[model samples]
Target: MKKLIYCVLLISNVLLFNSCTDDKPIFIADLGSEKIAFTNNFASEYLLSKDTKNNIADRFIWNASILGVNSNYEVQAAIDEAFTKPVSIGVSKQTNITVLVSQLLELVDQLGLDEDPKTTDSTGKPNNSGVVYFRVKSKIGNGGAGTQEIISTTHMINIKLIEKVPTSTTCNPLWIVGDAIKNVGWNFSKTTVCDSDVQRVKVSLQNGKFRFFTAENNWATGLNFEYYKGKGYTIDARFKSEGAGDNNFDFIGTPGIYELVVDTSKKTIVLNPSGSFWAVGDATPGGWNFTGGETAIVETSPDIWQATFKFSAGVFRFFKTQGQWDINNNYAYYKNAGYTIDTKLENDGSGDANFKFVGTPGTYTVKINAIDKTIKLN
Candidate 1:
């Protein structure tokens, strides 16, 4: 009977071991798995806009940090004052989550990501190429009855500092009314000046075209001229002589038979005109006077003759010598009723001559050049 009892106990032990083996294996879920990721393309430094939603399971959280030394990282989050409320399309429960973000070089600790915790090394050291980490947790409850914790997957985003290249663009100068050539982006340095940048873009008035140049082939700032699009006026230039070796000269309030010469070699312009000249005895010339006026004389060479006078809008008649035809109007005549030459009887040939006008209250400049022997105004 004792042997039978011992055998029975052994049989029961074997049965129990077999039963345990037949049971299913226990499975543990990977709590370190991530459902989402965040990546920085290094496009813009500031947040363009928010793209968050109110859905519980579909919500997203983003953070960044500049990796620094000694485990000190400056952090910033997408949930700053700029993104106070999440952009929502439908009704959903909102949960408060803090996102720490900062420059990439300051990040120290990194959460467990889905694939692997990408760090400077396996021991969590600083790396030349930095990483931004985001930790998010969701809570759903009102007062105390329905509180629940939902933790998001940790996401590690890789980042690298890169140097940007400069760029430029070019286009034709002429465009139709109400039309615009757009998207001409240019890269500019902090030290660029308006004159240098303007000169970099060459405008050809002869061919109505422009050329842009830069160091690289990138999108550049573009410029275009719209013809007859709106009300505009032409820039009329003239010359006036204060006196010999005198830089101060008033612009002649007349336009005709003037010499428009631009010598780019010396960066100077000389305008010489003949016949009726107007002058103001005082500093301000309100109108043309026939007597008691300062004589407008020509000066030495290499002078900026056209730049001496201020310009305004008005019709000015200039005395064109015989055989000197007008470019705009072909009609040419001498001693016509409209043509008036006031020759003073001064033996010195330095007397006041006035040109009469019946027009609007616009500005004008009369240029008299004794060397060129021509009278013109605009």
Candidate 2:
């Protein structure tokens, strides 16, 4: 009986040792070959506006389930493709998220793409449009940065700001200096117009050359301006490339007393002829003048258009040409709101296509920006 008990104890101890040695370590999650990726295709371009701020810009979706673990998605945006400094636009526990225009605007503003038309990027493109890099940092938990995360492949999307005028605007004047003007030769103070605020001026220039300068006697390299794009300085075209090496506007046209206008809203400088954008209706003088320039909105600064007139409460619409009702610039073109600021910009498809001018009958300035696609009445 004693011998049998010893053998049983020795066998039991050996069995216990084998069981402990053979047991595997506690189960640790492994990513293995599983990875996260955006499933839905992204739009190549996104044009954002204040009117459609609530509208969804993009619905970012990705392949669901990471090792059957409940993970979170962090959407980030950066100016560069490498995402040097990323701004988290959204965080979602679900597999997808809807990003609003306002949300993207925040990123656009952060990226410095929402700047005024006067600003240009490093590549000389307007700051209003550029490529924004995006990526999804999926984390194993709902916690933010530094958590166990698996980042998805980066994708770039082009974003453009259509408008920036949320409030008041001031048109900065550009003096037509250089030896082109008959009397004023490179003297910025003999500026075509004495008042810096005045955008349009009649200056007499001899058959020579002239370039637009910012301030008095400031002949700095970048402070001057010339034609933008590859196009030459024609009768009526946008010409406002400031730092282009050869910045002289050769006045091959008839040299005499000509009206030079500096328009900031369209970033265009024009001579005499001013009627690119016009407002028409029974609300003002030259009521849809079967002719042009009667209710013409002149260019004050680069890309900024301005005009003032005595207005009565009535319906009006903007058009490129006079004599007919062609709906190019309508009330709905500015914003969907029935009214903006003080005027009633009634928005609809049917008969309310025109904007309603409200309030006291007096002189008011109308500012229109073609690039921004916005109108302001003040």
Candidate 3:
């Protein structure tokens, strides 16, 4: 019995020793070198035209390195060399990225460049060619754990602005009236004239063609505009009506809502494919009249629409387009009482759930962010 007890004690000691040796060593990655180099494809100047499809821009290439254990790469552009206001251009695993002319122009606009070509920089330098700086950031791990970010040297990029807007100006095209439009019957006066604020209008049409007009009723459709077929949303092949020509826009596809954003200063038009999101029901100001004032949600921002209308003590639901029940309808509601900021509401397929206003009837605000797929009620 003494020998058996001795063998059991020896086995327990061996088991404990093996358990202590089982853990693997934690590996810490290197923070990598501070310096990074870009490849030969980098250019000093890039010409940005309105139509960037046919034009080939600059493709930035760089050498890849093991910055850390799991190194990821991102590119950023900024107006200032110090990167005070940086805009992320691209983030990817690849070491190369093609900076499109359209993207470069967008970055320039976001950097608060003025519309006039003769605009000056802060240092009294002529900024006719919008100069921007690009750099690359190589990062490891997810910043929460073992992570390090290494930035590359700033590269100069002078964006040459072509297709400058002509000095001539025309009146704002408020409503699109034509036979191709679903409700409009080519009669401007009796037709439901689409309104515009800040030279932008949200137009919903079937698979048809239409033309823009300045007046709400009758007379003549002045300063009409037409889009090229292969131009996509950019106004590359835009043809404006000088006098006698009719420039009709052919919208052939699924019948949905679209937003026509016109920049008179730049002489550019962006017809974006968008959702016809709005609210309508007894709780809304227009009540059941979906096509009238209650359902007309204004675009407060790009793809973010809001309206401050009077709501009655009732319930309402959101839809992409009014009167098209089977089309783009979101038949769901916010659970509990209502939704706060950035609250994502669910779509109930064919369910009849709706948002209710339990408080007294007065002026209220409803906002729908189609880009983020969220709603806000105030």
Question: In TM-score terms, which candidate is top?
Answer: 2
Score candidate 2 by lDDT.
0.65
How many collisions per candidate?
A: 37, 14, 3
Per the 3 Å backbone cut-off, how many clashing residue pairs does candidate 1 have? Answer: 37
Q: Per-residue CA lDDT of candidate 2, range 1-378, in tens?
A: 999999999999999999999897876456555578887656657888877787656577787655544556788878787888888878888777767788788777777775476778898877787678878876553243423667888888788888454443455556667676777776665444433333577666566666766666667632334333343323343233324465676666665555686544455557874344678876777665546535877665444578989887667777665544444366764565332433444443443366776667778888876546567777
lDDT of each: 0.29, 0.65, 0.60
Lowest-sum lDDT 10-residue window in model 1: 174-183
TM-score for all models, in order of appearance: 0.18, 0.39, 0.35
Worst 10 residues of 2 by lDDT: 233-242
Question: Which portions of model 3 miss their true places by more than 4 Å?
Answer: 1-29, 51-54, 67-71, 114-126, 141-144, 163-378
TM-score of 3: 0.35
Off by over 4 Å in 2: 1-30, 140-148, 163-378
Candidate 1 vs candidate 3: the lDDT winner is 3
